[model samples]
Target: MSYLFIILLAAVLVYIIFFRKKVVKAAEIAGVNYDELLDVHVPFYRFLELNEKNRFEKRVREFFREVRIEGVGTEVTDVDRVLIAASAVIPIFGFPEWKYKNLTNVILYPDTFDGEFQFEGGNRNILGMVGSGYMNGQMLLSRAALVRGFSSAAGKENTAIHEFVHLLDKSDGATDGVPANLQPPAFAAPWLHLMHVEMRRISAGKSDINPYALTNEAEFFAVAAEYFFEKPRQLQQKHPELYASLSSIFGQDPADGGGR
Candidate 1:
């Protein structure tokens, strides 16, 4: 064998031993059939060709390996794990080298809870959240909302995707929606202008984009990302400029079959 091939083989062997083994064990415990899970549950995977699907699968495995997932009040099944990993993978598939450095663990709850992880009267239906302050590098997800997010094809409210988008927004040390890591300095002004105009339109109920996006630029970006991935064609049709901006940041165009 060639030296390069030998070296690559060694690297793969090392990865399998040190990383892949742990993920395989986790999947076994969860009884996860990844191929079946992706085929049945993950809608975004439907758009990928075979080669891309393989890459996506690898990313999913790697995500599960790197991030620790624990159930708080529910048992995490293979489907639940797959859904969570898919949420993380779908958003960053366009950026091959990207990692959720700020994210290390995912805590799954049976349902939405308050910041202290307590369910109350008014704060009952939160879907998912990315952590900050003492809870940094963590994510909390509602199992029911998570299932519902991917179970339907009607709305752009995938809780997992929303929180992952927030993590991406937080990558540059802030989640102000500017995405300093992704946004070029020169493009910041135009991006802000676009956000303002869209927020106004949403406030006026003139746009079909989610009104929740009007909460702030940070939420606007996350909500827009959910639409970008879940309803790409509609987003591109109605808000081409915003879609283009998202395309620039994510480095892919879902409207164009995931940009090959």
Candidate 2:
């Protein structure tokens, strides 16, 4: 790698470590109140029962302890951190011992960014991305998309959760779509078969799942997860096999009492 790139990576790593220490200290002293804000803002949080909510809160706290969240050109808020943590926790809520070891930090841009990672000027269609190579162990999210994803009117397309699912898919060493860490060995063939069948339906314009899923196997997994978590009942009714597969993989069945 170029000396300049190595220096930049080192700088990011240093800042993340420092920021995490500060957050942990502040949390211990002040005791962050995730309830009022999470209840007021997050729909998924509200859908959870008292016990599940407690577990969710604990997981969110654990997320803050393990990973750092910082704004790129914007300021990160308590609400922002909670929402981001919720996105991470939602996909893995099924796995009590699960942790985002592949992700050490998240960078929230003010809005959409381009291929060059510029938030202004160039094409900015990308809303969220999992960093790789020199940027591995980090994630980028658009502030606008993050907020909207939690909004009641946002529908099944949750940008933040979608990216986190990609991270989950990557936990097994690749983001090829079959999350070996989460799924059983018997799952690979069945899931791929289901994925292809669904992709064909999407291509024919007959699927309620997003067409973005047709992009690739990885994208399909992420997009399907957004639907699974956002509209569990609907997804369960419409796509029983896919929903069942995801339920087995994630362990939580939001369709039934938040699947605690």
The top-ranked prediction according to TM-score is 2
Q: Could you tell me how far off, in angstroms, the CA of residue 194 lies in candidate 1 after the best superposition?
A: 0.4
For residue 76, what is the lDDT in candidate 2?
86
Q: Listing every candidate in turn, what is its Cα RMSD in Å to the true structure after a full C-alpha superposition?
A: 8.4, 5.2
**Superposed model 1: Cα runs more than 4 Å off:** 1-31, 120-122, 258-260
TM-score against native, each model: 0.86, 0.89
Candidate 1: tens digits of C-alpha lDDT, residues 207-238: 98888898899999999998998888888988
Backbone clashes in candidate 1 total 0
Summed backbone clashes in each candidate are 0, 0
- Candidate 1 colliding pairs: none
- Per-residue CA lDDT of model 2 for 1-260, tens digit only, reads 99999999999999999887887646642556898878988878888889989999999888887887888889888888989999999998888999899999899999999978899986899999999999999999999999999887788889999999999999999999999998778989989999999999999998999998999999999999999888898999999999999888788788986521
Candidate 2, lDDT over the whole model: 0.90
